[model samples]
Target chain A: MMKKSDLYIFAILIIVCVLKLVQIGYSRINFSTDILLNSFKKNYGEHIALKKDIIEAKKLLIENEITNFNLSEELMSNGYFKQRIVEFSYPIRLNETSKAVISLRNKSNTCKLKSKLNDLKLYEC
Target chain B: MNVKSTHHQDSKLLIICLLISSAIFLNYFFWAINALSFLKYVNFSILIFLISYFLVSREFKKYNFIKLFFLSLLILCLGSALTDWDARSVWLFHAKRIYIDNDLYGGFDNYMPELMNAYPLIAPSLSATLAKLIGHWNEIFPKSTNILLVLPAVLIQCFFLKDSKFKLMWLMFILLFSGRILINGRTDGLVAIYFVSCCLVIFKLFIGKNLNFLSIKNKKINRSIILVLGILFGIILTLLKNEGFVIMFIIFISTIFFKLLTKRNFSFEDLFFWIFIFLPIIIWKFMATTGGVYPRIIGFGIEAVYSESLTQRIIIRLTDLDNYKLILDYLILNEKFIISLIIFGFAFLKNFKKNEMIFKFVIFNSIIYYFLLYFIYLSTPHDISWHLNSSAHRVLISIVLLLTYFSILSFQGKKN
Candidate 1:
């Protein structure tokens, strides 16, 4: 029921639409990639800061007995950690000899305490 | 020959397109913004409608030039980021707030008094809805929504030209496509396209041919279609911007005057249909007024008109040749106005006396628009020079489209 010319016209339209789709997809990908990169850099900086706080907390525990101890409370009060970390890690009572080793893990191991080595420092894995 | 009822079909399609865009806008207002849910599924449905509306429509697919041109414009729009200050600071900024908050009222943070948060939500609603659908806000896709708003009017214009000579069609294409506003993510072009198309539909349906009561069996169907289309366009015209509402009022008044002279009658159904179409704006205004979101603009009041400085302001503006010089330079240097003038001259010469009443309506509508612009400039709340210099050209787009449309109709011969 359609003419050859109509078919040609439709083909041209389809081709143009494909080109448009490619353009949109390509631009969006580039934009999203840039944003993701920036956010990753920001998150990496936060991890570094969290490591510093853990180091400070370890030193405090080594020096004196902490009566009211909440690692998240200390870190958060210092304005470095976001809310998600509060629920992940729980408060622990430490002896003077025992060292707290803080390391960053994948999302699944976010607040879990991994194997403690001889070093009393914090590690971000 | 096939274009006999082309204008009728064009009106219907234009209304359908605007209504869809309006639906998207209102969906954000009443539903998406409140739920705090992105309504990604609804947005997906809209995308399907957008693609199929053009790609699958037999009328559109047959017009290769228009189809390719429209798709290319969409591609260009999507590829570009939001760069215009008004686009970035005013339009898309509003969209960002609404999209993030998912609350229409909370979106008012970006709507500062001087920045005009008082403007309507239709354009921002579309952009915000696009961002919601995408689940993240990027500068490009949301602005690309302008193309979606523009496509319907452009396609309807193309349909109106379906039977014209190829050369004429190309000319119309070049003229309409040359505007920078179309690509720059501004609502001015959208307003211009819709308002001009609204006027065209009105003229075609009322003043031209459909007047003979005895000839057609489908008259009732045709009248019902126009009534529905008018109400749809009326709703959109008002919601697009404040100026849009004024233009719609002018059209309403002018059409009623013409109808009275012609002794055309309407049923109670027509009145109710109009009331239904206008209900959205009525509710919107009620919210705005009761909530004190925006102060009522009292431009028409006797108090404002008879203010002590009216004469002083008028004399001062008129005496300043700089204002005339700036307006002249702006109009002359603008490509849209030049093309519009040429086409109007050609149409006036070719169809000198044919469709005189229609041309009168065109001229009347144009004068009312320009007069309002001139009056606003004269009594502006901002610096007059800056106000006129910045906006005169953008506002002229509606008039240019009006003249060009009538010129095209003239070129198509008097049979329409």
Candidate 2:
């Protein structure tokens, strides 16, 4: 009961959707490969790769014992980094006077090295 | 979905669609009020969807391709990580706050200027409810709510297009205009698609042909149901985003314009309904101001119009050719808008007289929204270039949708 043109149009749409599925497959593969690479490199202080903030925040939350922490002025000023890390790292409030400070490795706080991801470091001062 | 379905069937399909719309909205409402347990909310939503699915089982069979299409879309959307700025920083952030605190207002303190500014919470609330269902947050699960919210809007249109070809074209255009936003987890796509669906409701109630009135009781029930659905959509639209309220206002003004132009009888009850629906947003604004929600976008959205310094800036920006170029880059040079224009132009060439009324209404709404966009950009409090760079393309999606939608209707001739 369908027209020839209708079938063709539907076929074309199906093809387009198939292409989207393929795109999704390719993206997820890339995402998984990056996570695998991050885990493999995490011991050697290698890259955090794409959405590195997410990985870093989750790592800190899982690894840290602190209830509150502070970001160094440099990290605090970068709006994108601050917002993403803060949003991802919930129940770990960012307090100015907290003993735990998240800082760049070279700008370490005078405390124990709690955790580090790429250049981002968690220090309990 | 079949051409053989009678007008009676079409009316029933629409009523079913409206009920589905109401169900999608309750995902947020039931969660916001905490009137239903999380388990209850999930089960209730599934139950409503099942009942609606069975009620229109015949059309569902004919339209099974759309079901598969949405499945493909959901799978694709679910696989992506949330990297978009608004998704993470604004919407999902609010969702996280609500999830952790189990209340909405505790996180309203001024934090990041971009993050703390109170945007609407419908998308976030839905996403939060979803995250609660899974008992944790992830980059993927929260954004799935965005994709799911797009369903009723898309389903409502199946009854609007008169034939399979037009409906197929509609599906294709969804990809062309909204595919990226659908995956990226923003309210812009929701607003664009939902706004068009709302406009269709407006057209049906006001401008288009009469419904299958049948018995007097059936007529009253049908009309009342349609009116209530419109109000529900109006409330949902205003709560979606600040721009949503503007889109709702344009629908109001455009319908009034059409009524005046056609010398149609205007109903005071409809006027009162618009006022009643806007109560939620008015209360929201009052809360934002009184509850220490500082520096709302009221600065750029409205206050900029009359602020002495801001008006001068707008004038200065208006004179800059590069400003015009930047806006045109997003609004005109974009591929989708150009396609919309070509389609609309072709439709006008073919059947200008037949679709004149609808065309006029669409164009009037389109023009008002366009000017408002241009003015908002000119008066923006953020870096104008940054604001335009970030949002101009998203805002223009509605216009692209409107033009192409009317073009599809135009191709159906005046019979629909």
Candidate 3:
């Protein structure tokens, strides 16, 4: 039912679609498998694994009835780290206005030490 | 005239999508009225009923690909961490608040002045409802609401497949186009799918009958289906994301503008679609405004009007070629954009007369959408390069998806 010229266009469409599928299809399979395999192995993504300490420390803060907190100078130096901590332990405010301070590097000042978790130390700022 | 041939399937898909979208809104409504304690049960009831209905039906066999794709995304989402920064801080964080406290305003009282809480609540509200279903939140399952919201959009695309070749191509196209977004628990994928679907619905309402591919024997029933789909697309698109809001506005304006360009007599129906589409978003914005949850940092469009230095900066950025260069590189000078443009352009050339109106609509809509992008970029309170770099790629999803879809739809490849 199709003219030869129109069939040429249809063939071209099929070719282009085939090439795209090969290009992106391979990439997707790779990416998905990596995520799936990693997820099976770790039960969570690497980012969450990296933040496991923060998660644990958040639980500690919740247990200790910490309402507000500050970050250690080393943690404060990196904006992303600061943000992660704030978001993870949100509802527990993060500012100099807080009496509680969470120190990942044990940088000491006038704040009194309250709790510790493997260099992740909490203090009364 | 085979009145009952394929139109029923199309209507079925659209109605399911409409109901699902409405259920999300209804959850918010229930919460707004302080009746959420009861509505969650009803929500669950509808969900279980739909699932049971789908499983028992013979039509389920045809949607095998959608089912498979959704299940895969579910697994990936389940094992995935809350990684994406916006997904974590803005979207899921809002869900976390709603789940834990049943209060959207709770974060504002704390140190979250940076959170854009005014962004519509469908994503967060749906996630919160999912969490309520679980009786508590896990970092794992709650974010799956992202894919739940995306499923309807993706599933509806299956209705448009002309045959097996188209279906295969459609499968590859979604994977190739959507990529990680299909699983990442963000709303960009949702926005992209819904926006394109809106375009198609508009086309079906306007110039589609003239096209052989979309001919329906029962015009009245078909019109109802397209119109309802249009209304739902408008609402869901607007509420999905801020980009969705801008694109929905462009769709409305583009419809009238296209009619004007074609010298067609515009009807009250055009205005009707626009009104029905935007009513939900207007109420949402009103709620944000009244609740004081609206983002104040980007206050009044220009952040610091009194500061001469800031005014000068805005002018400088708007005039800067480097910023435009970055935007060009991100928006159009990329692989996906160019490839999609090429295919759509080819289809438009080969079948120019048949697809003229919809092509014109896309062109007009895209120009206005990108112009708004540029204006927003030039007028941004944030740094220009950083703003474009962070979001330009993700923001490009909707338009790019629209192009690719139309290319597939219009690629008849047979001379009429």
Give the alpha carbon lDDT tens digit for every residue of A34-60 in model 2.
432332121221122236664576577
- Residue ranges of candidate 1 with Cα displaced over 4 Å: A1-125, B1-40, B57-60, B107-111, B164-178, B211-223, B266-270, B295-312, B319-321, B331-335
List, residue by residue over B1-416, the lDDT tens digit for candidate 2: 33445455655655765676566567656655555565536644673475447335775554565676576566655655667788777877788887777765545665544574567677787777766666665565567677666766776666567566777678778776877777677789888887887887787788765653333446677677677777777777887888898899899899887888888887897777788668777766677768667544546333333455667878988888998888788767988888898998898788777767777778888899989887888877666778878988898898899888878877874542
TM-score, structure 2 vs. true? 0.86
Candidate order, DockQ descending:
2, 3, 1
DockQ of each: 0.03, 0.24, 0.22
Docking class of 3: incorrect
lDDT of each: 0.57, 0.70, 0.67
lDDT of 3 by residue, B51-72 (tens): 4455456655556656655665
Best by TM-score: 2
Best-performing candidate as measured by DockQ:
2
Error of 1 at B312 (Å): 5.0
- Worst window of 10 by summed lDDT in candidate 3 chain A: A40-49
**Off by more than 4 A, model 3:** A1-50, B1-8, B48-52, B104-111, B206-218, B263-269, B296-311, B413-416
Candidate 3: tens digits of C-alpha lDDT, residues A24-74: 334432334544445434224434423666775676688779987777777
Candidate 1 clashing pairs, residues 3+ apart or interchain = A103-A123, A104-A124
Q: What TM-score, to 2 decimals, does candidate 3 have? A: 0.84
